[model samples]
Target: MKLTPIGPAALVLALSAATLSACGGGGGGGGAGGTDAPADYVDGATFTLGLSSDPGNLDPLMGAGSALFAVTQFAYDPLVSVDGKTGEIGSQLATDWTVDDTTVSLTLADDITCADGADLTATDVADSLNFVADPENQSPFLGTFLPVGAKAKGDDATGTVTLTLASPSPFVLNGLGSLPIVCPSGMDDRSSLAKATSGTGPYELTEAAPGDHYTYTLREGYTWGPGGAGTDQKGLPAQVVVKVVENETTAANLLLSGGLNAAQIAGPDGDRLEKSGLSAAETTGLVGEQWYNHADGRVTSDPDVRMALTQALDLSELADVVTSGRGGPATTLAVNEPVACPGDSVSGALPAHDPDAAASLLDAAGWQEGGDGVRTKDGQRLEVTFLYQNNLGSSGDAAAELAVQQWKAIGVDATAKSQNETTLTGTIFGAGDWDVAWVSLNVGSPDQLVPFLSGPAAPDGTNFSAIDDDDYQAGVDQAMGMTGTDSCDTWLDAEALLVQKADIVPFANNTVRTFAKDAEFETPGQLVPLSIRMVAK
Candidate 1:
């Protein structure tokens, strides 16, 4: 499950370190019908979901929004489906799979058909894999869901798809489990995917309006759902409407009014809903992270400057500010479930906050404190730009401002700016005018971070940070040989090495909560569409 970016400040700019107080008052009812649902609830009814942001693109490969990922599951099926809570692998399009070093083979299910009514063959599966595997495709999942340079070959007669990796992958099955397979038509026409979908999943995209709402209809005879959930299941909403309602207050109101069946609410609004007897499913992941720009010409390119900038702030305070004091210390990049690696990489691994040490580090690096207390080296001010996503809510904005002030105290001029996810991604990966950024990329495995952490800079790769860590690379290489829980220790070691170098700082981990209003669904991060069961209403 992917996390919707989260961060701290109140809806207002008060830097109060107060833990969240209880809700102002209880909501309108004894919950959306207590233990028993309304008698009118039907399996074919529409389930309306309220989302905080629009999933701009419907394409599973391109979209980063947690909503998009959840909705994608409704339309597309992975070769293997993983249990969101447990690290258990289940069948979807592929009934079985096996791995031997660099070679991973999968047995495709023969009964599956695309939304277009075309048979979903092993060759189509291979094409989908190869498409994302090709660097020319420029998929963000190139090194994420599927390793770049990996080749796929399908045997049409035998219903088998073989993935030959360029290198041994540590959590290859986990990667495959997250990959959403596309049919030939969707693979051939990329633009169509933004508006429509073609895959063998529980639902088919019936309508989409980009930033407004999307409607999906259940596909009949979809027995290959994650853990064998089928369209024939009782209480399954026949039509799912994913509506974009950015304001949490408005969403909470909708939930109370029965205009929506489910919504993910955080912060104060969540507290209010809980008091009203609404139950929430909580999923915890890193939501506050600091990444230094390693691109040439950026002040953060200097290692000492990066270290100094990182050490300048009291991280615990920053975490509190970002989470509105509702978060814990981040432990690992593998925050999403079923987490491929389970270990604490933050506790003693990340650098502690020390302004004095930061100032001394800058001084030793030839940056002298100027008249205004800002540092200067070679006539250039020790200035850096901090970019973050505005959708991370007010808390993120406050945290960014707080970080800027902290940097200032350390004689570093830091500018904080917030952009929408699209603009933020462009600025970090395309515009390349950033010095540092607060971007939390939550993936299931440490290997999923490889392309983003170390490799060619983006446009070509997701390595927006431009990291080149020999130790991290060595650790990843060693981890690839091990599988499942066996690779956890090595993956943690690799992650720790990156943190030790101050390449990135993941500070806050929050239990992001989603409130269900007349619909029952489990949230690993986003509401599982197939898991949704409309209560009788």
Candidate 2:
């Protein structure tokens, strides 16, 4: 597939780190279910959802983050949508579509119109795709969702938009389903998109209060939702308020007091929320994954050092600590449900905990242990600056502390640093000042991860860790040739190459829970715009 070559200047602020704590959740309950709303649909009700952090730069194309992705769904619509339960491709803005090796042609619905009452043309849709496809635009979704080097053409008379890809992508339709298309107004004046909505979704942004909250008013006569779902249904909220609540506990308290309609509680607060009899929607996501910087000059660049560090800690204990005993061992890099390849690639692929073995590896690498129990090679101490997201709450902090103690016992000087989502993204993808990171990048398709794993290193590309495993790349090359599930076996084997060599250590998978009091909704990754329903208490 074609790849967007992002320069150093753009890399610093382009890629936003995915929040592990707020990975996936919606206003409904018990797995992905929340579509079954009560018979009474409370009209004129305001649905309040809590976010752990502010979704900076509201422009959908330029910004990326779980918060921003979640918020964008309220005011923007994708070309298509995949059913969270059946995995079936459904219509959103595009009424129908035909996909093949190098081309995808989508037929737009005639009735679709922008929030401003302007008719949405096929040209608008094509323009949105082409904007992201251009490298100069620096859209983070380029390689992840929209194929790089892709081009689009539109015929307004026939209401059809055609896209030609540079290479054959097995999961092209699924990726397109996640990309939000901007209306002509937003595309014309990109600056207005920073704090406004100009899409053809079921709602329009009425107010944006950066760090406080974002309010969206429901748009009447919205009938072109996923699978022809309409906003005229009973119980649909008249307004949506996304309140910024950084603390999980505070969010839970709000949910209990009925002050908020929904909030995702990943920490200890989740237990109480489950018993409170509120509706919920749960999505399994990677909660604890470790990555070593393979860039030159970093101590973790050495293969021996990476393997030694992997064997230094009891991953099971770390997993429990990180997830607060609620999660289990990770099975695959793609942890979310409706996973294209449903199989384990992590078990028996990593080294078991053995401090003695770890120390031996260090000795073999010519690192001598000093009087202070720190290893030094060529007059340089083996010091590591580890980073983890602070949104993982107290459990994440505890897990980092435990990992540090374990590394110290092996004569490695490791320090744990906690950063919020925005700072952490910049540190890993921009500053490149970290040795190891406990962060997660969630995606449904294995192809979506290739850009972040194998391509050019940061400052030049999205491969933040600078991973350069030839065997993994070979496997991916082979897998890319096949189509759909036919390539799953090869994809799983490719993930194994990374694990067997200790390039990445994925340890925990948590059932991310989002609780709702007076509302019900579903989230494939973010809340489905059409699945939301307001209820009277």
Candidate 3:
């Protein structure tokens, strides 16, 4: 399952610093916007960002159903923010917080003034929570986000909102972080959160002129923020106009041609970026991997066979064909993220390379090489059909083709097929018609991984592996029900358990980047730069 967002989980916990040097694409020109003097803003500096896909809908509360959720961050504020770079809790609408096992008390900042100049309060936070939790919203990601029993309570004066959880969940804060607070004054009707709407962030969303462009004007005299970004960007870019360039090639060409400042580039757009003097930024995320359906009662259910399959493929070689030392192999979903057990962190959870062990594991599983160079057991061919979407960009295609060859070399009968975006989603992700599929799934939280990885969900669910191992499910259950851990032991243990299952093979995590042609702006400091507040050039 290929997913997106939150560039490197570390930005929230660490610093965006020089992370841009890792992805090798996109660069910005430097200049002053409003910092010098809000009134004497640069005559020609306008921060124009680009989105490769159309933001389907502008409602953040609508969940991840459309690409628009990412853009909605431009005009919305979540109760909390999970620092992508740091993996720690950071304030957004909430100023401070206190968390026990199942309850979280948030002290909402009183100084917040929305675009409408209405004083933000705890009551506004409650209203936002209720909006997402409303069953009528029909958001596919609602269950994983709002859940069933979570509640918000508090008053507007003190600006305190208390979140009560039904269980100890590692994702309670993250879930809140994902929830965007709407204006309570007119929030009773969701239509108030319109495209050309108002928000309280550093920049006020003045226009979302469908596809062609969107604009944001500085919220004059605005000073309230939750820290990190909220405090750092004192002066805003005079105006930020985001342009929609759906083609990566055109977007990259414009960035290189000095037309636009920065554009997110994937696929062939990255081919010449390394030598283009551009920075490559990235962080660990929902890595694209090879998923084998074990619960479907295929040969993949055999533990040794799974191990052998792992041994047969050479990830190092695969990386070679991937991005010239840019791709890092993944063994599990959260292998790249920092996780603690109870009191401390450990490195034992990292994925390791073991070519010999992989070959041996498969051999022991009785998948011997047949006369035709294909592995077989009792006349059954060791074959699995893998599905991949062609539009994901060059990296996805190159990665899929490499996977096919690697698996075939090990006597595994593997074939790669390309499908369009909608058809692929309907057939493989939705219909579960695939045996083994290579996909990328990136999100803000690792706990929400359940709805996509395991657990019972509507319409076939995201258990792409079709694996129903009790042991594996137990680890997932424990990971999902955690609040805070002082160490990474249990987290690593669960990660190892999931990796050993071999139902999902995490190969590499890519970067989400932005570039600018003018100096009046600074890096957006977000995986999807527009999601978090943007600092002016």
Candidate 4:
């Protein structure tokens, strides 16, 4: 699944960094206008945020959900940082970088130090890269962010870290920006990484309550932040408290009562929060995406069945209902800002809603409807488990039920199973019991989606759906061969191949918002912790 802001799952692929730059530059422009410098500032103040779900595992390499990613951003500093507004590559841990042919050499910032008071070294940086680059480690980030067979070598004398790629990667810098660097201690004992913190980031994990909340204390003299944000920035919260509330109504009530500084809410609660004069930073992303399991034993494994399933529902109506009329028709798989290939891939690619066509297709596939309007073949009922995340607000549940009903109408018994993020991740990557899943995996680039689309299936790799389309692979190969915006046409074409073939279905695109009360921060995709500040309360 593509790494996107935590929300309802949407079946979509990501764009390549080169494709994103080629499309319209990084989509980091302003949203809702409350992120401007605060007129009055309070130092050493605390800021509390309400989250809908627990960020399961804190390990960036093992965690799959966006909430875990968001939390990681607070404790670990990436080698590079991408500007959300301008799409420009900025310095974070690395001061400067040069891309020559297939190799990317970075000049590490010499002055930065980890939260443990250890000097950040080039060797430490190289070790982290090398660790993820090794597939034997089974990090989800392998092949997705770090190029396969990539070698990292560091020189302490000059503080230089050179990464030699086995193959050409157009968005190497973008991937590095998303990869959070782990300290030597965190790297040595990875289990400790799940609950502890160590890095060159601005904050350190001060308290950890797991499912309840997490507290972070700002580090003094820390200057290494995304876009060069310093520790002394005006109104910068000295302490950040992340509270997991899970309920939208409860979160909204907390926002209104000033018990919470900021919270991400959608549907009716979001409407109510916005109407109350709260400043919301709206981040556009994919929602209500459907992914059919292409594993051998699954009913959706059949191409005809996948196509018939796609043709059964009215995506237009589904999008409206799923987002509670707050979203538009999906246009691209790369819904996150700094979208590399932004175009209408969902238009002519997805099958139109036609119940008759769906029924006919199923009939052609030798699935006969029984007395109860359920299809059966060879004494087996056409029943598939439909899994969705329970954390995805009220409309997400409604959308799942509606899809189940629609599938029932088409004689396919789709069981709606709502699982929490942790359960869903484990099930998809561990047990592989699901047939169809509602998961939104929106990364910044299409290269990131390579593993999910074509590589090994779950239990081995992230291609949980077991999708293996040769035509799509051919398109990806052509696109990857090109550099920068030069690969735009081929990238879009590759995305179209997936959509046209019904390998993944992206149904809704919602402009999700995070309501802020007595606080200000940039919610480009997720909350930028460095940009957060506590206003007068």
For TM-score, the strongest prediction is: 4
Lowest summed lDDT window (length 10), candidate 2:
1-10
- Each candidate's number of clashing pairs is 8, 4, 53, 16
Once superposed on the true structure, which residue ranges of model 2 sit more than 4 Å away at CA?
Answer: 1-39
Q: Cα deviation in Å at residue 417, candidate 2?
A: 1.8
Across residues 1-537, which tens digit of lDDT does each residue of candidate 1 receive?
243444211000000111111111122222221344335445678988876656666787765445567577788888987776676788878888998988999998768888898998889999999888887767777777787679999999999999999888777888787788998889889899988998887889999987789999988988777756567766678899988877767888888778888776655677778788777666676777788888778888899999998899889998887777888889997676566778898777899889999999999999999999888999999888888766556677788888998999989888888875545666666747889887777676777777777888866666777888899989888987776678889889888988988988888887776676766666553445666666654
What is the TM-score of each predicted model, taking all chains together? 0.90, 0.92, 0.73, 0.93
lDDT of 4 at 347: 82
- Model 3 quality (TM-score): 0.73
**Tens digit per residue, CA lDDT, model 4, 1-537:** 344334421111221111111000111232222345445545778888887667776776676666676677788888988877666899989989998878899998768888998898999999999988887787778767787779999999999999999778877888888778888888889998888887778889999998899999988888877656678776778888988887778998998898888776766788877677776767677766788899888899999999998899889988998788988888877667777666787788988999999999999999999999899999999998988776567888888888888999999988888776666777877747888887778776777778778888888877777899999899888877788667877877888889998999988888777777776677555567777666655
Would you give me the overall lDDT of model 1?
A: 0.74
lDDT of 1 at 466: 83
Error of 4 at 234 (Å): 2.4
Ranking by TM-score: 4, 2, 1, 3
For candidate 2, write residues 34-69 as lDDT tens digits.
Answer: 365445556788989887767778898875556777
Q: Output the TM-score of candidate 4.
A: 0.93
Which residue pairs clash within candidate 2? 28-280, 28-281, 29-280, 41-235
